[model samples]
Target: MKIFYPLIFSIFLFCYEISGQYYPSQEWERKSASSLNMSQPLLDSAINIASQNENAVNRDLRIAIIEAFSREPYFEILGETKERGGPAGLIIKDGYIVGEWGDIKHVDMTFSVAKSYLSTVAGLALDKKLIHNIDDKVYEYVWDGTFDGSHNKKITWDHLLTQSSDWSGQQFGLYDWADRSPREGEIDDWRARKLYEPGTHYKYNDVRVNVLAYSLLQVWRKPLPQVLKEKIMDPIGASTTWRWLGYHNSYVNVDGIKVQSVSGGGHFGGGIFINTLDHARFGLLFLRNGKWVEKQLISKDWVKSVQKSSKAKSDYGYLWWNNSQGSWEGVSKEVYYAAGFGGNYIIIDEANDLVIVSRWIDNSKIDDVVRLVQNSIK
Candidate 1:
């Protein structure tokens, strides 16, 4: 990919400062593929590959949730679930829409892509000094019994962000070990296993992820949805249609107000229900290093940190999936994305000045989509 070509993109906003590019308002500007110096045929192929290769996740998300976690002990959807639409996506080059297909305005469950949004909130907290440091023990801020245990006491904000907490506990009636138990082990044996030192093990458990959400709620002293909306979403000109939801039982009293603690992903159910356009806006924010026009909404340091690999998992970062360890073969190692169930994604290619959002595509086609999109540039 000619990552530098976007700075000199022939389409629009040319000859401006490197950081100065289009910022969408209610209506986003569009440019044809050929005008952007991209092969329209190749761009069309990328969109067709995404729109045609629909994922197998059921439209009735309740059933989809059930089938997904069927192996978990007594797994149940504790939050609201919505039926999803067909494949939809957007391809933005130089902050302008270059290629799009399917129902881009249709709101759908983005699943774990919400985790990356959660990471943004954490970065905001750090920027505001609410979180003094990333490595600070979470127990310091959340003095409650949540992180009281010996094992969980060592868990820092970084650990939770990277899914390396190995925090053992229950939240909103969901058990940590029960969420994704080793299929080979018996239920009794799974719980009896030794806990890995905090930040040493990488396990993808939604219950643990929600624990991070709950901890952040304590630190922010308000609803995380509020933090996200004010600090990230609104500044980027995102629509009001998006919703960040949690389980029915996830509400907690904070500052004399009942605020629902949001989830990092829709594991049991209830995450971000957002349209493809909004997702594109979010990716564009990261592509611009958390800036919106003249304002640096979030620190570039934090933005760069999210792309770095975590010690526990080389392909993982602060709730963001990184390509640093080459998780996707032949794809740029600089690319990082938020991937979710049912093939949802918000892919950020900063080096190329691109943001791509796709929903309900086949999981296996993402690499090809990236390759084709990158190859489209001249």
Candidate 2:
């Protein structure tokens, strides 16, 4: 009798462990779908299109798109339609999600898409007096003494946003950091050096973004993730499961203490991972001018400022990329976008009231992808 009881107890424990490993609770399932809120008409159209579009690429093609450009081997493509291998991609027209694809119940990484989101957060911080101005030297908050004697001190939030920091950092090199984990000292050494006079030229560097993240921490007296959550994520009803990646492989930092960087930060920095549906929710937030449902998450002025292009050759703005082609195929030149390596994109056409988001594997022919997106809209 004693042996029988012990055996039964052991069996119960094993069963519980196995169930826990495979079964996501109802709460988790709900959290995964938290970002999915589409209007009926739009959802219906998306579903119809998804079902009928024979040329629509499959998951394999989507993965190929990202693998061509990114070091990461895996990817997910969410769309605003109900179809095979779909992840939830919220299609917003005039500020409401009308359709979704894939598992609307899953959250994904947004990668550099987080940059634009962070920029909006910074704008809100400024409006609330949490941050002063774009021209304010970042060293004012996090004084590392490196910018003191160099022209780099002139580098401001404005410069970083516009990708005009003039630091001579290569965009592809920054994108490659996902595979190469450099030491802290190496990163610090690079930070200390000025590639060009601040605000005098344009360069793309992920390290500059890290500095931005660190500056936010210094000024807010809270981690960047927390600031984002309270100021933007919660208001937008964003899922609590999301995260952002940061330097040193940490998510959130308090003074000297380090925590896991949020998935958004890590994915954008090439350290974290996520699902496709969450990406769409993020897009919806921007499409709605920072208003999510009943709350004003970010100021509209901030959104306009970040979306507009700076006086740079690349037509960049606060990490957002503006239309540089002037006109393509009679299409109006009023498009702005937030793009990432491995074919992640959030393109907003305010004039047309459209927001398009896609996640794919890295691809060498990014121009082809861009052209395809443009053609689709036309």
**RMSD in Å for all candidates:** 5.6, 13.3
Compute each candidate's TM-score over C-alphas. 0.94, 0.64
Best by TM-score: 1
Q: For candidate 2, what is the lDDT?
A: 0.53
lDDT of 1: 0.89
Candidate 2 segments exceeding 4 Å error: 1-88, 95-99, 167-194, 247-274, 327-331, 361-378
Superposed Cα RMSD, model 2 = 13.3
In model 1, the clashing pairs are none
Off-target runs (Cα >4 Å) in candidate 1 are 1-20
Backbone clash count, each prediction separately: 0, 37
